[model samples]
Target: MPVAVGSYGQTQPSCFDRVKMGFMMGFAVGMAAGAMFGTFSCLRVGMRGRELMGGVGKTMLQSGGTFGTFMSIGMGIRC
Candidate 1:
């Protein structure tokens, strides 16, 4: 009798898994982009100290959430 080998690419991830992965990736990218843009824009507007921090944080969260939602939807549809 021949022994069977284990296969690595046999299973497909669930829809929720795909969506979660997409959301996490998109959120990370969005947060980085938002931070860069927010910092520059806030500085240009003369925001300083706590105000700048607040603005940047807000921008990061909003952009991250938006990107995550869209990504999750797209990924879910692929499954």
Candidate 2:
């Protein structure tokens, strides 16, 4: 019997995987950015307590989604 010396495996991620990774990274960055900007804007606009929390949350989600979508598309295109 002969022994095989080489191993073969998937060296690249699939399209879906690339998109997913991009989305996750973009989402995180977007959320952080949204938080900083949202906080200042909301505060300057006089939002307080529950309103402040709601505003920030909304901003975070929106920005995260937008960023994630674009990043995913870019990643997919590069593939």
Candidate 3:
């Protein structure tokens, strides 16, 4: 058998892996932004307690999902 070069069993990440990582990173960033906005809006509207939590949750989920979907589409095109 021929000897392998470089890092042996360690392989470079494939396009799919890179895309998936990018998508996850984008989703996290989006969620953070959404949470900040939601908190500000809730405070502005005088929302309190559970209502504030609910608003933040909704905003985060929506933003993360939207970012993930768009990233998926973009990655698909690149592959």
**Which one is best on TM-score?**
2
User: How many clashes does each candidate structure show, in the order listed?
Assistant: 0, 0, 0
Candidate 1, 19-70: lDDT as tens digits: 9999999899889989998999999999999999999999999889888889
lDDT of 1: 0.89
Off by over 4 Å in 2: 1-10
For model 2, which pairs clash? none
User: What tens-digit string does per-residue lDDT give for candidate 3 at 15-78?
Assistant: 7886887688778977988899888988899989999999889989888878876876677678
TM-score of each: 0.85, 0.86, 0.73
List where candidate 1 sits over 4 angstroms from the true fold.
Answer: 1-10
Model 2 deviation from the true structure expressed as Cα RMSD, one decimal place: 5.7
CA shift of 6, model 2, Å:
10
Q: Candidate 3: worst 10 consecutive residues by lDDT?
A: 1-10
**C-alpha lDDT of all candidate models, in order:** 0.89, 0.90, 0.80
Q: How close is candidate 2 to the true structure, as a TM-score?
A: 0.86
lDDT of 3 at 13: 60
Candidates 1 and 3 compared: the better one by lDDT is 1
**Between the candidate structures 1 and 2, which one is better when assessed by lDDT?**
2
